[model samples]
Target: MVASTHRDRPIGVFDSGVGGLTVLHELLVQLPQEDFVYLADTARFPYGERSQAELQEFSLQIAEELIRRQVKLLVVACNSATAAALPLLQERMMRTTLGVDVIGVVRPGAVHAVAATRTGRVGLLATTATVESGAYAEAIAAADPHVDLVQVPCPDLTEIIEGGFPFDQRVVDTVRRYCAPLREARVDTVVLGCTHYPLVRPMLQRMLGPGVTIISSGAPLARQVEHVLGSRSLQAGRTEGEGTYSFLCTGDPEPFRTMGTRFLQMPLGEVAQVDVAGGALAGGGPALA
Candidate 1:
């Protein structure tokens, strides 16, 4: 069994922005007894356009900051970052004093989609960087080589959702445009490859129709988290009381609090600001302390 003190440490989750709140929501629901510290790199939001090297650097920086908080595990909730940096992050985490496990948003969803598909055809909707990275395709192919994978790279969908929720016609049009190819492919399963896409899931469902199974990273990733924690004997011992959750953001905390509440569909308690200097957290936030 892992040390009791290590098991008592919070699970750290990070994303480029509020999008990762969707993933955190599942963690909150499924692992209510475990504390969570979520960090949003809002100062560098919209990770969809960054280069692979930039993403790796950003992810490593975030991992180090989360490690500083004594997190028992690290979750890279952004698909773009996961695609670009999962291996490197995992390697770094293994070298930590705690040997924290690093989980990301791609493989679990891919496995889930492969299981959900009836026609051996799967579709993926993701940001440009994630799609271009070919992460989902690799994951799906690894899970089931026979499964045909169709990918749609939405260059602007993340921005559209982030710009405003309760989307308008433009959002509808963008979703439709993205789903058209998937619809044409007649895929019975679709993987939502971006963490932010869940915010527009209803619109995506309508666009893709009821016959398709939509797999997002949240639910499956939550299960993986449970398994990992349990296997390592790191599950929280609390049997009744709910766990506490806190927030940290590299940008202004107010916007993160406001936007995150909407995304998580839960009251986001205090949000603390993270001072990022040279891409590393400089530790100004009370949450970071």
Candidate 2:
């Protein structure tokens, strides 16, 4: 019999905004027995424009906060953060006794895109920061050097998905405009480099056409999370009840909760407003275990 460990601790997930909720959605589906704690740095939304040093600092602060909360795993669900700060975050975590695994969205998406592409022509739709970071390009090359990657950096896609209500024509037009280059490239596979892209996946799929396979981070990352937990014997053993989840945002909680439910497609319970350092929690009631 295995002694009880950190198995019951919630898995921590964070993004620049509600975009990482897309990753949480996959984790909830793939590992429903485990609970989750999600943090959104909405006050600093659109982290795509932030500098590498800032991203590293922000990622470290968030990681320390999650570690304080006793999270068993940390998932960097933001592409910009993953591209810029994953190494620093992981290195910092290595100093801790728990040393939680840090998984990012870039390599998994790249590997999936590479495996999915048949024609050797792949397209990437991402924020300007992610494209500029060149992380995906390197990952795709490491996975398969022969595959050609056409990357398009969209300026307004994340903001549109975050703020645009009712999914208006502007959102469609923006998505269409981004997909135009991918369409012109006639790519066999497209990678949604940003976590927020999943929310508009249907629209992206339609824009990219039915034949082109689209890959996102959530599903692939979810599988990796599961594997990490299982290999380390950190998986929750509960078999009778559904795992609970809650929200912590650096900005207003109401908007985070409201906008987040749409992204996660699940009920978002209590949301507390938190500071960048992760202390000074305000508002929201306790989440059920």
Candidate 3:
């Protein structure tokens, strides 16, 4: 693990692919003065299809790389990874010199969806692995026992969004296909359980109608991040000046840089390519090799 914390160190965020940029978008807006380091594990993209053990290994490798960069905090922006690896990741971080805090998306989005529903019916759209993991269902039940959940397993939604042409008719049809059950279930509030879904939120809203409240991990998670920083005194405290951010990915950086701007809605200054050496990341993985 790296040395103890530095207040000026960037907050680290990671996902299986570009999906996590939705979370980064919110972080950039909510914590404008705080620097961030974002990692996209695109070499093994679409974590929905990966096994739980594999996801944990990939997460630990990514975390080790981020910790080497000396981030003050870590956010698991991928639902599939979060469902499988958050506990292990947190435990590993606790043994580190810095003991960085780890935040995942399921609980925050689930709680918000539960609160947003007026008809006691909520919908969830996530990757197959995330849906199968039952993380959102458990979180929603814990938050509000009275709420009913309708979950849809989107096996290919992430891949379609990752292709970079999201506003096309095919994308709309795919979203509509996933949203049909929510309409049938009469869910008044929906949890966009996968970070990539937010990019197609307008289409989702149109299909599900104006009344359905769409809850995603970004804004609510941003609030939680703010609270964590203030409580722990880890905030950058950079008043008046905006903080900078950069990108790291295990796959080719060219496509990452081109496609990332759409999801991030901000200039992706420079993207560096990294290779993750797997197996036991308790300081085993090298930094951005």
Candidate 4:
């Protein structure tokens, strides 16, 4: 861990691939005054399939790199990482890091889902590890045990989205197939457990129907950021200035740059690449850091 300046530095956000861009988009809308540094671990993406130990190691390495960059706060925008590494990262930070704060998406999303469900029936769609971890179920149960929760693991959804595949007929068909149980349960609200799922909201909406509310962690996660910043008096004071966003990736930047723009609905310039060697992040050739 590095010494933190605790200055008004940019907030750090990261994901397994480009999925976290959905969270970043909401953060931008909610806190436009704050700057952000986003890192996409594209090298070992589809974190859905990685082992718990591997995910934790990768997450800690990424967190160390972000801390080195002097980010004021860290957001684990990847749900799989959140499920596997959040507790360990939180403990490590408390003991060794400075004034920076770290938060994960599961609790925030779960909180929102519990509040939003009209019939107390919530459906969760996420990666296999996330479902197996039972993070959502625990969060919802802690908030409201009365809430009926259904967990559906959509194994390959992240890969499809990250690969820049359209949420066309095939994708919709896949989602419908995976969500059949949730639909059969007659749940009125569904939680998009994976960060990548937000990118295909339209398809989800169409399949689930207008009556069934679909929620993603992005908005609630952004609200959590705002609440934390306000509580700590770390809120950016500039209300009229344009916010800046910095992008970094662990793999080739070209594909990320191309897919990122469409997902984030913003033009992305060259992205900087970082290499993870021996479970540590090393700065590679700089395109844009």
Q: Please provide, for model 2 over 166-206, each residue's C-alpha lDDT reduced to its tens digit, 9 standing for 90 to 100.
A: 89989989999999998999998999999999888999998
TM-score of each: 0.95, 0.93, 0.94, 0.92
Query: Model 4 off-target regions past 4 Å?
Result: 1-5, 237-239, 278-289
User: Clashing residue pairs, candidate 4?
Assistant: none
Off by over 4 Å in 2: 1-3, 278-289
> Compared with the true structure, what per-residue lDDT tens digits does model 1 show for residues 90-173?
876776567889999999999999999999999999988999999999999999999999999999998888886567999989
Better of 1 and 4 by TM-score: 1
Off by over 4 Å in 1: 277-289
Candidates in order have lDDT scores of 0.89, 0.87, 0.89, 0.84
| Residue pairs of candidate 2 with colliding backbone atoms | none
229-267: candidate 3 lDDT, tens digit per residue? 888888885678999898999999989888999889889
Residue-level error in angstroms, candidate 1, position 25: 0.6
Q: Cα RMSD (Å) per model? A: 3.3, 4.7, 2.9, 4.4
Model 4 sits at a Cα RMSD from the real structure of 4.4
Model 3 clashing residue pairs (backbone) = none
Residue 123 of model 3, lDDT score: 93
Error of 4 at 240 (Å): 3.1
TM-score ranking from best candidate downward: 1, 3, 2, 4
TM-score: model 4 vs. ground truth: 0.92
